[model samples]
Target: MIYQQFQRSPMQTRISGPRAWLAMAISLSLICLSLFLLPFVLLFGAITLGCLVLFSRVYMARQIAKLNQAQANAHQHDHTTEEPHSHVYNSVNIVRESNAKETHRMRQQGRTFEHKEDEH
Candidate 1:
């Protein structure tokens, strides 16, 4: 039962700091054995880490923005069917009256949608 509780190490945890630096140090020492290699190793590692951090930050920011937009859309959807739709709240549902306005706008724009069946 005690042995059953133990699991193998995760792949994500495998690519860690000390181990990664050890691997890098070995590779760096093999390529260049000078004492000057330490500064380069540390600098290169820092730059690599900074780039990964920045990339993840940008990706997370976009994801959060998309989530916030979806939340706003949901909130707008909640107010769609209520009376005085635009003038009162500017919510999106706008049952009969808003549809008519949208239709009028579409006619003015001269744009239409057509759905096609996929051959696959």
Candidate 2:
């Protein structure tokens, strides 16, 4: 069997710095020229679009976080619906950290150690 050497294409190059700026400039120039003929311009419509974009981003972020948390909990083999959780902190540096680590003790007999949100 003959072995083939695969090479990455120019199109697949990582975008950064000058390359990214050049691409942006080209795209903006194209859009400006192409869309110059479009007649109607409304400030209300622009504002509405901006608000919709902001709301959608916030909504999607919340949804993604919820899904990730559920997936993480599932991976840790979380069984019960009502789990007793506690806010814990390192005895030394309570002042530095604002977000407390949640401590969970598995009620089941086989599990001995503290089961944090990341149960594994």
Best by lDDT: 1
Worst 10 residues of 1 by lDDT: 88-97
Give each model's whole-structure lDDT. 0.77, 0.66
Per-model TM values vs. the true structure: 0.40, 0.32
lDDT of 1 by residue, 4-84 (tens): 435655655677789898998899887776576889989999999999999999999999999999999986986785476
RMSD of each: 21.5, 22.5
Off by over 4 Å in 1: 1-34, 82-120
lDDT, candidate 1, residue 78? 60
Q: What does candidate 2 score on TM?
A: 0.32
User: Model 2 over residues 1-120: C-alpha lDDT tens digits?
Assistant: 233224545554666679798998999999997677444456657888999999999999999999999998874664344356743345543544344343122222343556699665
Task: Determine which window of 10 residues in candidate 2 has minimal summed lDDT.
Answer: 100-109
